[model samples]
Target: MATTKTVDLILDAGMALVAGAGPDGASVRAIADRAGVSAPAVQHHFRAKESLLHGIYARAVDCHLEVTAAALLPVVLPHAERVAEPARQGVIVEMATSVMQEWLREEGRATLTSVILHLLVHAVRDASYGDLASRWLAGTVTAFESVGVAGTGDAQFLVELLIGAALVSAPGRFRCENDILNRELFRSACGARDWDGGFWLERYRTRHERTRPDSDPSGEGEGLYARLLDVCVALTAEVGADALSYRKIAARAKVAPSSVLYHFPNRTGLLMALYREVHRRFMLAAGTEEVEPRAQAAPAAGLFAKLIVDEMAGEAPLFLTSCELFLASWREMELAPDALFMRLERGKMHGVPQLSPSERQRAHLHSIWSLGLALTQYSHASSHRSRDVELRLRDGMRFLDD
Candidate 1:
């Protein structure tokens, strides 16, 4: 029989492997070997591969939640009590930042990294977990709202940033010229205008509404390219970017599959084009006009953050596809520089600024942090709390001040 200590040893070994090679590498025999136990002994303790994975997943979630709750509890309690002192609010943020930073240091990283990666790599299997995370975050936000001390970022948004920061910053994940991408995304974001924040809604009748075949006997007309892109966007939302296929896009577009190839050439090309369109729309909706190349950063960043989160909540599937592509870029060597370049071009088209290296780095961090916010809010279907969402964005825009 495996002792409690021995079980700990087995679970630890399994986590180490998962972190290094992801979920695919954590085979039972491999776990057994790593744990220095016989295969049957490993099975005796965990009867199935899935059972073993669940063990690790639960363990990681518990550890993550415990640390999170500890840090958030103080702030939440005061908020729920309606403590509304400005001084207290400042103190609470400082204390919360300190506690959260502690987790980013040393052994805390090791403890959290495996779990975060596990969550990301096997995100599909654990759809329900995201809901739990959403509820946990909302509670934290509500706690703060109840208190008079208003926080710029809600608990859920803050933790979302933590998970994202932990994942990419973890040594195991690939790092790229994110600062460059950040500048472009920020610059492009600044180029547009007109912000309406909502979730899953239809726009008021546009001047050029397309006519469906039943209505006009023509077809969904005047927006074939736009319609096709919308289909791609919707497809990404439904099946995720990983499963996005040309055949699927064609079927949804009601175009020939070969026609998709005619326009896109390949999967990468299709995705790149689709994201460009999506990003363009994002910029237009997020911005009104460009400022003096971030002569001021916070105001501009705030606008973009608010816009991004609004869209994320309403159009999560699109953002999830974007997330999928973002991860894909990290894994595909040939995709590099192109992914960053395309983003830069988009920004230039919308007119992004020429940022200093340091400034660009700050902007990149801002983009990453924002993505984390979106990932948390939209990736799961949970109750929407608009106040908390705004708090998350305001807090994240702080990175722009650097």
Candidate 2:
């Protein structure tokens, strides 16, 4: 609307730029120019660039959650009297499909939805996102609770599944890969079962049916732990963390479920171990550099920049799935792997004599923010302009200042 306020215009412009050119495109000048306003106007509305990015992130989250749910409601409500609650879940496939198709029809919404998803999976690693994420998720939890949908043992989990499925499957990005995600999420919402194993796991299992599950013979299970972790990580890359199961893990490891459980006991044990393995590898990659001493001497930013390039280039899937697990844990109110790992790592980083308390905190936030931006950039189909990425990197460097 022409009458839209300055902040809203800036948010819209920022979202548009991100959608078109990835995280690198959301520069202050670009957003300001798109909004037909001076750079000062952008700063006037949102003082810091970080705050502006958060504005875009928050707006995108709100828009997707509200719009998608609203779209679903209208269709479901029309037949409210005729269909029973149990029956509603089964019959609403067509309704859900229509809602999804409608979501795909609008490029603006689709882009915004993807951007919000990017934020949810990455920006959330920052402590600054805690209040915002909690507040938004609280509302989401309430909405799902009120629905009283059958077969939803955990309303919060279903809420997350719905959001993830809708955004990941949003039209045009990766259609063929996401179709199963969309269908399974729809069925699960209404009252389907085994959503975790429904389509994603089944597909993976079916394709790899030739690889049958077996137990280690002759009491020779020396490298079982490492093999299991590797298989779990690979499976996580293919299907999401939420879709993982002990059976799936065992199936891929080519071991009896009991053999896999011998090391991990339970699914949580397996996942936590898998998480730690991923973290260990990431730390080694980020910390180990054969380059000049200058790169290593600089604070977190330099190492993070190099790590971003490395992760995006060859480690894309691992980085992608790792972030997905981090994000899912954050949503479910479980202790995040980063939360635990950072505690140990933070103590090491704090050994620097010059760092202040406030500076330390900012650095922590900056580290998380950088990872989120890197993840967002990796998820995109292409890179934004060089100037755009440089602007983001330059502004981020300011956080290193005490």
Candidate 3:
């Protein structure tokens, strides 16, 4: 028992170090010192530093899976009712948002996500680790049924989206920009007042119309919408979600603010177009080739990861727009059911290749796990440092045929 306790202690210390310093910071000697154990003793259980790190990751993944499951428990009934009554979608959304916020508030939740994300990146190269991750993902999706969001695809997307956000923000070590955006996102999710789509649109259109376009020789209006989106993507990648605005986007696109408004009309129009464009680009990058059953599943999973990485790495505008959309959807769930449903459906469908009939029964559970894990990874990549994210994402695509 004492030996077991010591091993656990060592793992805890290692996770703490990784959480604080990122992957580069957690060393075996440092872990030993932090755990109050001798270096050799640490080596005894872990065998090597890599093994120790993996162990920490495994434990952290398990802990996050548990917390996520607990978070879903309170909303199961409402989720079920939402299936029959479309009007109840808002209730379901609120339930999900509340559960996630509660989970974030729990102690050590942030570090746990960071460690899990780091491990997931490594898991791509290690089949045993991958299987462990797969199992956890499966379990998380199953837990979501208690709330009523049924399809595996939807479950998967939700898990990935949430996990991606967490990975971007990583709980405790939140950046100022992320904090502001996340707080707004949380409010939007909870039916709070600040997330009003009308208000945002009004603000964007009013500001955009105030500026004049330059008399460039080229008929710049031809591709103004596309150019603006590109600029938004660039801005979003550099900063967190808070940096998106007409002035910022116009400055980056080298267009007059009025030009932007002329094409987009209002913030709502701009945001809707941007969101649709992102979806289109994401699907294009994801490709449309039908895969053989043996390989069918890989493309969706890889696509999901790529869609997230591209958005997170490129700029803040797209993500900022995403947060606003999330809020907008929450405020007016009925106004955009298709969009919400599509997002949910995409997540659930991404994991279809890996499950069988029996496993399919557990699809929602797996979806949540994958989503949670994905979110953790995205959050870390956005907010923390982990060399393995790109490699791991690459590995996730290996099953695809180019």
Cα-lDDT of candidate 3? 0.51
Worst 10 residues of 3 by lDDT: 208-217
Of candidates 3 and 2, the better by lDDT: 2
Q: How many collisions per candidate?
A: 11, 0, 39
> Please, what are the lDDT tens digits per residue for candidate 1 over residues 1-402?
548877887888877666554555679989889999888888888998877876776666566556655655565554554444444535444434543444444465455544553455344335655644454445545543444444434444444545444433332222233322222333322221221221001111122123222121223343565666677776665445545577777887788887666655677656666667666666666653542235354565556545655554124534455555544443344665444443333222235556444343344444456556765654355455455555556555543231
* Per-residue lDDT of model 3, residues 1-402, tens digit only: 999999999989988887665444689889999999999999899897777876887788678778877777666644555454334445545555654564456377656755655554445334446655665666666666546654554454445545544533433332333344334333332333334432322232233332222222245555666677766655543442234567877787887888776776665555455555554554455453421223344444554455444544353323333433432332232424333322332222232355443222222222223344443354322343233343443342331122
Query: Which runs of model 2 end up more than 4 angstroms from their true locations?
Result: 1-4, 22-24, 75-88, 91-104, 146-154, 173-177, 188-402
lDDT of 3 at 263: 72
On lDDT, the leading prediction is 2
For each candidate in turn, give its C-alpha RMSD to the true structure in angstroms.
11.7, 20.0, 14.5
- Candidate 3: residue 193 Cα off by (Å): 14
- Prediction 1 TM-score vs. true: 0.52
Q: For residues 1-402, write the lDDT of model 2, one tens digit per residue.
A: 543587788899888876654454468899999988989989988999878877887887788667656665755465545456455555555455554555555557666655665565443235465455555555555544444332223444444434534533435434444455456545544444333424442453234333112333224674887787777777665445654567877887777888776776665555556656665656566653322222322444445555555443122345555555543433333343332332223212312455443333333333344543454334333355233333444443432221
Ten consecutive residues with minimal summed lDDT in candidate 2?
342-351
**Structural RMSD, model 1:** 11.7
Off by over 4 Å in 3: 77-83, 124-128, 172-195, 198-402
